[model samples]
Target: MKYFTIFASRNDTNDMEAVIREVYTGKHSIEKTGHDYTVTRKSLFNRWRIMLRVLSEDTNLDYFESNIPGMMGFYDHIPFADEHRKKLVLTQISALNTMIAIEAEKELGDEPFRLCKELLSKIGGIGFLQDGTLLDYDGQVIVYPDGSSGPADFHPRACTRKIRGEEIESEEGERRRQASIHELRERGIPYLDTLPQLPPVSECRWKSQEEIARRAVALLIVIQYACDAANGGELDESKAFVMGLLSKYGVEDQLTEDERRLLSEEQPDPQEAVNIAWQYEAYWPLIWALQLTDSLDFPDRICDSSYAIEAVSKWGSFEELYRQTALRSREDILDAADKTYRLHWACVNSRIQGQDAPAGMIESIVMERRRGLFWMVGCGMEDWDHIPMDT
Candidate 1:
């Protein structure tokens, strides 16, 4: 059997699926099945809205049993189905921001791979075959760097999450770190059980010291540019620098919702501009990881922006930064990752109970910092753009 494969780095699956339909159905108006519901992609002018019907997954998989091939790693990891019939499956949707790598197979020809190549071209995505070939969006082989790779390698991006609800007061008034997990046991997150465990350092891959150094600088540039756009800096779409940054570093897919909107709108949202400015919190830890700074400041307040900027900008070039770079161990990064993960739960619990964040633990600070740490630890191999802050 021949196989077809496609990989996409998209902020969310909504746009990717719509574009996929455009390629699949020749731009004709049609309804189809998607991850969560049936979707109709056509916009019929002058038509009234109507109710929708969705599909049911009533079909059995390989005699009524199938493992979600998504996170479980390899097919060779667990043998399934008949020792006779050939089996091929691909699953998972970027209902959230995600890096999606998919493969399809046909008993005869390579049409599926051809179609997948088309999809890849349209989405500006990349691909990796089981045999270790990395393909560009146009389905041509790319020069693979020697020996260093991971989720960060394929999807080299920095990310941020949107904070909803009324703003919670953040301060350094309380001088204690967050209480232990047992103390907050009563404040269980409903979705807590559903989140993925942090994969061990030995089991996961990592970005190189130089690449991490370059990307840390890239994150600062992206945050600065995006904050500028959101605060009425420049709204025109013709500027090629923004496009270059967004595409090259996968930055567009990693934007906050309001930051994403600022790219299209003629006017900018002032509040979100301030919000994005505070996103310096996300960049600081990378500086720490690169050994630019010593230790992270306590997360009870905002990151020192002046220091973060000076620390990163002081480097004359990527090589200059790489020369001074030293990424900490994955174990070290994961330790902080786990700590922040729990602190995020505390912040959520405080908001849920209508109380201030415990011990003055700043919600946004904890979140942005975790975004950095989680990205460093590969966030359970999650795409950087939409790494969940789920506790």
Candidate 2:
């Protein structure tokens, strides 16, 4: 029951039904309303020419998030260019990637091709709603509604024309593209001429640094109280502080599953205690996000619990801690989000391909960092659990 739309040109004069019958190999029905033709293909992405001709329009893709399989030769389509935009020279269609997969990228050497979007939940962290799968025949990603890190393919109902479909799908063009990368690498850089403008911040009000500081403080309070309960420390004093935070910010709901259990019960299972320790991994990212710390280091190991505890402990009150906070600029936060997004893709890909994580990245570190970044960039989303972290 996967439903999506194909955006075809109004100028396309071919009989819509005939076109579908010619290009689509599967048994499906097309309900031609006005300009739109709704077709059900028993399968998706089976042929080269069929794939190209299916898309005579792509402007409708704006309703969905777009990902590039590789660098699109924007210069190849000068008519689609805008001199005022950074995209004019060449804009890299970024898919989820890490350290720029220089070798894997050779498979998708720069060539003029169309882009498409999935009409799925646009809210998931990079791959939360989308699985990274490649087309069996072509090795291009199958863009679904939820999301797709489409490095090199399109659906019959997806794709757009940056140039004639024939040239791009031609044997000569494919051969040229294979050789193009090595020559470009040998002579000059094959990197983005310009970065596309990232999606703007959502209209939802962004949480102030003060609010996040309070959140961090509240979470720590609960964790500390849980520790005392576990270690047979004075519950009375610790409960007072934890209750105070709950009374104000109520970040208790933000705790991990085990941490939430700790709120009710005094004792933590041995397994729970290990998870609670990893809460520092979660806590460290928040402090880093708030600029309370500089960089969040590599994820191969645990973050310093002492430094994490001290971060909130040094400030006498929640208000005092927030007052000292200077959140990073939107650009800085987005950069981190972009970095995590790509690295996360790498981490997921490694597991799928049975290889080591790129750049020694651990799943936990990337997950924690992604959780923090997703929250920060998500504009108005306040609930920690509500934040999506699939990438």
Per-model lDDT:
0.51, 0.46
Which pairs of residues collide in candidate 1?
Answer: none
Q: Score candidate 1 by TM-score against the native.
A: 0.46
The C-alpha RMSD of each candidate to the native structure, in angstroms, is: 17.7, 14.7
Give one clash count per candidate, in the order shown.
0, 3
Model 1, span 3-64: residue lDDT tens: 33444434444465566566656323434454322222243642211111211112212211
Q: Global CA lDDT of candidate 1, please? A: 0.51
Q: Give a tens-digit lDDT track for model 2, residues 218-304.
A: 667676775666576776777677777666644555555545676656555645554454456666767887888898776777787
Best by lDDT: 1
What's model 2's overall lDDT? Answer: 0.46
Local error of candidate 1 at residue 350 (angstroms):
1.4
